[model samples]
Target: MLDNLPLLLNGFSLAVSPYNIMLMMVGVFLGILVGVLPGLGAPNGVTLLMPLTFGMNPVSAIILLTSMYWGALYGGSTTSILFNIPGEPSSVATTFDGHPMAKAGRATEALTTAFVASGFGALFGVVVVTILSSWATRFALRFSPVEYFSVFMLAFGSFVAFGGGSPIKALVSLGLGFSWASIGMDTVSGSMRLTYGFNELSRGINLLVVVIGLYGIAELCQTMQASPGTVQPVATRLSPREVLRAVLAMPRYWIALLRSACIGVWMGITPGGPTAATFMSYGVGRRFSKAGARFGTGEPQGLVSSETADQAAGSAAMLPMLALGLPSSATAAVLLGGLMIWGLTPGPALFAERPDFVWGLIASMYVSNAVCVIMALTTVPLFAAVLRAPFNITGPLIVIVCLVGAWTVGSNRTDIAMVLAFGAVGYFMSRLDYPVAPLVLAMVLGDRTEDAFRQSMILAKGSIWIFWSNPLAGTIITVALLCFALPGFTALWRLARRQFLPPPVASGR
Candidate 1:
């Protein structure tokens, strides 16, 4: 233990170095900024700068990337609380009460709750990753291709179950994303797909361009469809009395933190990201709160629960990368890619070879968490000021940034076109009531899903039975199948309930 402490301490040294600490601060700052912006997220933020990080040292590169990751998550709650728009999917839960808190003139209190909870959750996640990483890796390694494929299936199934929209639309969006994911050359046949016959076709769609197009440009265009307006952020300063009370006032909130942390830890290791964790934590918070009656309407607990889970999930996602050598989320994937770019091989060997790097990252989580809170507390008023900007100005700027971000990804004009195409598609699909989450999830998982299926077939010597042959694989498949059937059952139940209950007459009507 003492020996390990020295290694961890060494990691702390690097993490706290002026450059690294500054990077982490920047990451938090960016996280907050991006989180405040609608339609942008950690994935897009990371991919937006692939070219820059490609040449940097792994350690410094990681510090910058990780900090950005943290910052993006931090910024998300600002949108949720101020405008009722979730800056990221993970912030969806925040909408439950964060917006209302602003509406009720308790915006400062809500922001404070969100910041503190995020720090607490991040701290918890760091501890989990530090102590249980080896165990987590061992468990992850037990999954074979068949099992892995089933897990993907489960993720999709669960997505549809909880999407709260039309299943066909969700499937369509997901299929589109998966099709896009297939754009690169096929591994076995080396055949190009969906490339439209350009030389750039061989490289496939750049995800950064896709994200910029789908979220940023399309979102801007959609915003143009409406008359623009200015939104002044609700301004309220918390007094020392309120601060002391808010800090120690809630016992129930800690329970919410625990549950949110569980959601974060579970999803971080799986395909789930901060978005899923946010949604799950939100639902759970609503279900568990006795004050549920006040939910979605200025309840401090709502912001705490959603924001806490968001940061926790983001932080814990580092475990699979470090311990199992698997990159579970987009940011983690890029972090893995960055490690490769720096000539470092990750896996069990990485810990043995660069204990300081691994331990230092762990220590930095604590530092970053503290930094995020301190910064947020001092600057909540400033963030709220962004809401004061005229939508006409901000919308066009968002469009330009999206376009530039897309074009810059590969320094290719083709990427800009892709962004426009995706943005148009996103606009149409969104209007048609398609749930976009499945599509984004599919794009992220598509290649991996295909690889898993193919590997199982190869290992089984072309036997389709390989997908369901092993007991673990078979069970996972069976369970996933059951999970997939849930939406239909849910629909039927809702219908039954509606038929049985008569509508109450409105007082005015």
Candidate 2:
């Protein structure tokens, strides 16, 4: 550990450089600007900026992009608190108490509390990243193709079993993602399988294009088609002294903050993203809050718990990206692009060869997070001004961003078309009790799943029993498969049993 000091310091130096600092500030500013808007979200904003990085230095490029991601995290809370609209899915949790608090005439307090919560949560995330990165590196090194395959299978299984919906619909989404994943030039046979006749099809579907289009562009289209909701401004003020007092109001909340952060970190360490963390934390917060009844009506605990978890998840999401070359979110997906542009490959080689890149990025997270807090405090008035923008004007701007974000991925016009097409699909999915996260997760992990299974097969030399022959591989596969299949099996048994059973008597009767 002592021998690693020099490299750690080098990373700090690079991350703290004037140019990188400026990039962080710029990213945070842009992130907030978009986040505070009505329809724009973090992923769309991050995706739109990726194309411009093609000509920049990788480190600077990364600093800027990551800063934006952090900024959006901060930014989303503003809308949730002020207008009851979550610019990002993660911020939906924030709306329960944040918007209600505003409606109850504690606008300034809720906003400030949210800001502090985001920073505090982010702080916990940085500490986790700083302390656990090395351990993560060690663990990631043990992941062979079999391990990765099992991991993806386990993750997808968890989603399917837990995702509340028709099993057929969920499976359809998963299979579609796998099919779309197969469209690229075959990684093994070098044969084109699904490209139809287009030359771009041979180069295959770009993950960024698919994700950004599906998540962002589609979301915006749905928003545009729907009736705009009520979004009135709240006028309130809280002094520094008052804000500090507000933060200290619930000493117990600090415990909640820590708890939420842990939940977020755990989710990110797995394949889950901030949305997963947000929902999980929200559930825990609901169960634990002393004033639980006031949560969706107006309570600071609801806001604090949700925001804290989201930041923690976002922060921890970086671990797998840095340690194992796995990206758990769309922002991480963009960061993956930045890593490639920087001429760095993520894997065991990274830990051995580029400790500075790893440490510098990790250390920079501390600086950038602190910077976010201070900047937000000083710039509260500025963010508040975002409320001044009329919805009529902001709506078009968000749409423009969505379109551009959709087009930026691969410069493919088909991707642009898919954005609107998928937007309707996404909106309807939302209406039908289907989940988008599982679909996106499937799309992201599909290729990796194929690669792992293929490699494991090749290693086994066409022997079907090879997976079972290795004890470790066998156990992981068995667990993953069981995790995936058990819920449906249980559901089927319940359905069959229900056929012979009579309905229960009414409670009153």
| Candidate with maximal TM-score | 2
Per-candidate RMSD, Å:
4.0, 3.1
Local distance difference test values of all predictions, in order? 0.73, 0.75
Off by over 4 Å in 2: 1-7, 164-167, 236-238, 250-252, 289-294, 378-381, 406-433, 468-472, 496-501, 505-509
Question: How many steric overlaps are in each model, in order?
Answer: 10, 0
lDDT of 1 by residue, 1-509 (tens): 34456666788888888888887887777767766765566666765655576676667677777877877777777777777777776778887888888788777677778877888889888888877755654566677777778877876776666566787676787798799889979866788877788787789775556666666666566656643563445655656666556667555587877888888878776656677788778778788877666777778877777788888888888886776445555566656655655677666667767776677778888788888887766666676676566766766676776767776667788787888888888888776788666776677668778988888888998987776887877876877677678777878898987788865664575
Candidate 1 CA-lDDT value = 0.73
Question: Candidate 1: deviation at residue 191, Å?
Answer: 2.5
**Tens digits of lDDT, candidate 2, 41-73:** 666677778877778776677778888888888
Instruction: List the candidates' TM-scores in order.
Output: 0.86, 0.89
Instruction: Compare the candidates by lDDT and give the number of the best one.
Output: 2
